[model samples]
Structure formats: structure tokens, C-alpha cells
Target: MKLQYWGTAAAEGLPAIFCRCETCQKARERGGKNIRTRPNAMIDGVLKIDFNADTYQQSMKYGVDLTDLKYLLVTHTHSDHFYPNDINMRRQGFANYCGNKTMLTVYGSDKVMASILPMAEAKSMAGLLQGVLVQPMEKVQIDKYTVYPVRGVHAAAAGPLVYAITDGEKTLLYCHDSGPLPDEVFAYWKENGLRFDYVSMDCTSGCSPMDYDAHMNLERNIAMRDRLLAEGLADGKTVFCCNHFSHNGAHSLYDEFVEIAAKEGFITSYDGMEVEI
Candidate 1:
């Protein structure tokens, strides 16, 4: 399976729209991978993990053919991850392109469905927006691939979600906009005994204050990697990666953060980074 990183910034994005911090300033000055848009990824050009506010630009920048994508697996309803209005573009008479025969199917938790329904209803129900409310640990099939939505504790009121996908060959666990791995996730790992080929975790806090319940710092990120390894959920062959960075992280530039991550045998994901598992 092929995984492409479209964007790699947290909610605020790198060189955040309204910030003047030194890191943001430096990111602006550097203006390459340092200038991130928002977090989103596409797997094998068919399934997208998250559709953020920056989806348009991210897709354009990456030369992604959005219309052909088969699935959109949303992680959560966080503004940075889910933008209902953008998705409404798929509705007939809304966008320029003719619709695909197989409408892009979306999978997410109840909270995600709630956030999307209103806009979809407004767009006219023409099968343009199809969806399935994914349950925790329940495997759903999209073509030949299986998708699992693991409940995340990012938001207390609304249960946040993350994803794991496999094509019966390789599995990738996308853990973002989330803090520590929930117990249910560990239980699923134990019950399934599946070893993930790639694990991309949230490093929203960078190296700053640690908040394991809401986001992860560099230290906590490494700790999670260790625990996943110890639990046999992943092995050394796993491509451990970190992403979803906040401007507040200790590293002011992409290279600065990447240097440290590389030293620890971790890949610091940047916009346009591609991995084949």
C-alpha cells in the first residue's frame, strides 16, 4: 500500500495564519516543508484518512485526483480534520466535475456523522454523500481493504476517532489529533495480534509541555512507540513516524525536529512524504 502525507501541521498549521511567533516566523522564512498546511493523508490514492480545511490546496499541491478516491476515513470532527462544507462539494450541481459512479464513502464515529449530516442534507441527497458509522474495533470492508475506527479521547464530550487500515497485506495505524493510546486500542491489538507496518502518531506538543490526555509531546511520543513495541503491536521493521505538529513545539524548523527524530529511528513526516508498505 502507498501512503502519502499531504499536510503535517496541527490545527494552527505551520506559520499559522494569525501568529507572529519566532517558530512561525522562521517557518515562513524557510517556506518549504517547514510551511505546513494541515494534517491529511491518502492511502494508495484511493482512501483518504482525513479531509481538513486545507484539503483543496493539499490535494492541488500533491497532484491528487480527489474525484477518483473511493473512501474518506475521518479521524474526528475536529475543525482541522473535518470540514463538512468542503465535502458538500461532491453534491451534484455544486462542483464542476461530473460525479463518479461510486460515490465517495465516508467512515467515522457518531460525532463525525452528526457533523456531516447537516451539510449533506443541505446539499441535496443524491447519493453524492454516502457514509457508514464506524464502530470501535469493528472491521468494515471497502473493496478489498478493511477499516477499523478506534475511539480516541481527544474530546471528552464527543468521542474522537482514529483509524487502522489493511489491504490483507500491510496495516497502517493512523493516530493523530489524539493523545495516549486508549486501552481499547491496546485490547484490539492484543485480540487481533496484528503488527502494524506504519504508525504515525500525534506530536502536537512537540517538545513542550506534556499533555498525554489531549496531545503528545516528543517524550510521550517516544514512550508510546516503546509501549507499542513491547506489546508486540509493532516491531523494528515498522516505519515509526510522527506528525501533526503545533507551532509551539520546541523545534522551530522542520530540519531541527527531523534531526532528532532520525536519531531515534523515527521518521518526521513532512508534506509530500510517501511511504509504500
Candidate 2:
């Protein structure tokens, strides 16, 4: 499987809309990787993690064939992660896109499902929507993969989720926009001795004064990595990565985060970053 990072910024994106913060200013000065959009990812060009607000820009930047996506797994209905209106483009007569009449299976909690269902209905996108699969805190098969949707400690009303996916051979933990692991999720990992080939965590605050609750910080990520390793849930071979940065944290702070994560055997994901498993 091939995984690509589409975007790597928190809600407002790096160099946020009209902020004059030093970090945002620096990001504007140092473009490239320092520049970030909303958070999203693509797996094998078929499975997409989220349909962010910046989906169009990400597609254009990476030349991603959006029509190739077969499944879309949504973590929550957060504006940065879910933008159902953009998905309407897949509807017939909406746009002349390439690729076959792709089927996109979206899985999420009830809140996310509710948010997307209306859009899918209005656009008459049943052919493309496939269905809204409500996620549970247990492993379930979707297409050819086993996906486990774990409850996350994010917005109480939004009903956030974190995912652990396995395509028979390799496992990937998509942990983002979430705080510390819930007890059941940790128990499952501990009892099963689960090890992920790739782990993408939420690192919204990079050594900033911002307190980490729903999202994590550099210290939290490092501590989480240590715990995963100590519990045999991670190995030296595991590719641990962090993403979803906030503009307040700044671009230079992200560089510092990358440096710190590198020392701890973690990769800092950026837009267009790809990994094959």
C-alpha cells in the first residue's frame, strides 16, 4: 500500500488567513514544506482519510487523481477534516473528472454521517457515496481491509474517532485530532500485542504554550511513543509519524518538532510526503 500526506495543517492552516503572528510570518517567508494546508491523507490512491477544505489545492499541488479514491474514512466532522460539499464534484454532471465511476465508501460516527448524508442526498450521489458506514469501537471489514474505529477524546458533541487499519499484512494507526488513547483502545493494543507499520498522530502544537487536550504536542508525542514502545505496541522498525500543525505553533516550531521527532525515531509528515508499505 502507498500512503501520501495530502495536507498537514490544523484548521486555519499555516500562515493562517490574516494572522500577524511571528510563526505565521515566518511560514510566509519560508514557503515550501513550511506552508501547510488542511489535514488529509490518501492510501494507495484509493482510500482517503479525510476530505478537507484544502482538498482541491492539495490535489492540484500533488497532481492527485481524486477520481481514483475508492474509500473515504472520516475521523470526525471537524471543518478541517470533513467538507461534504467538495465531494459533490464526484456526482455525474458535476465535473468531467478522469478515472472510472469510482465508488467512495465513507465511514464515520453518527455526527459525521449526519453531516454528509444531507449533501449526498441533495447531490443525488448515491452512485458515488456508496453508503455511510457508522464506525464502532471494534474491528470491522470494509472492502478488503479490517478497520477498527476507536473513540477519541475530542469534541463531545461531534463524536470523534481514531482508526486502526489492517490490509491483511500491514497495520496502520491513524490517530489524529484526538487526545490520549481511551482505555479500551489501549487495552486492545496491549492484549493483542498490536504493532503498527505506520502510525500518524496529531501534533497540532509544536512546543508552544497552547495546552494539549484534543490534540497533542511535542512532549506528548514523545511520551506516547515511549509508552507504545514500552508496551510492545511499537518497535524500532515501526514508522511513527506526526502531523496536523497549527499556525500558532509556527513553521520554525515545526522544524524544531521534526528535529526532536527524528531523534526519537519519528517522522514529521508534510504535504506530499509518501510512504509505501
Across 1-277, the per-residue lDDT of candidate 2 in tens digits comes to 6889998888998878778898888788878887888899988777788887899888888887777677888888888999877886778778554445666777888888776676667554655765566655666677777887788878867768888888878888888788777667877876655688888888788766545478787677778777787878878888888888886653334565678778777788888889986
lDDT of 1 by residue, 1-277 (tens): 9999998899888988899999998988888889887889988888888898899988888887676667888888887888878887776666555544446778888888886666556546455667778887788898878877677758855557777788989999898778887677888877876789999999887768774488887787799899989999898899888899989889836878999888887889898999998
Query: Which residue ranges in model 1 land beyond 4 Å of their true spot?
Result: 96-101, 118-123
Give the candidate number with the greatest TM-score. 1
The residue pairs that clash in candidate 1, if any, are: none
Candidate 2 lands at a TM-score of: 0.91
CA lDDT, every prediction? 0.82, 0.78
Against the hidden true structure, what lDDT does model 2 obtain?
0.78
The residue ranges of model 2 lying beyond 4 angstroms of the native Cα positions read: 96-100, 191-193, 209-212, 250-252
Error of 2 at 148 (Å): 1.0
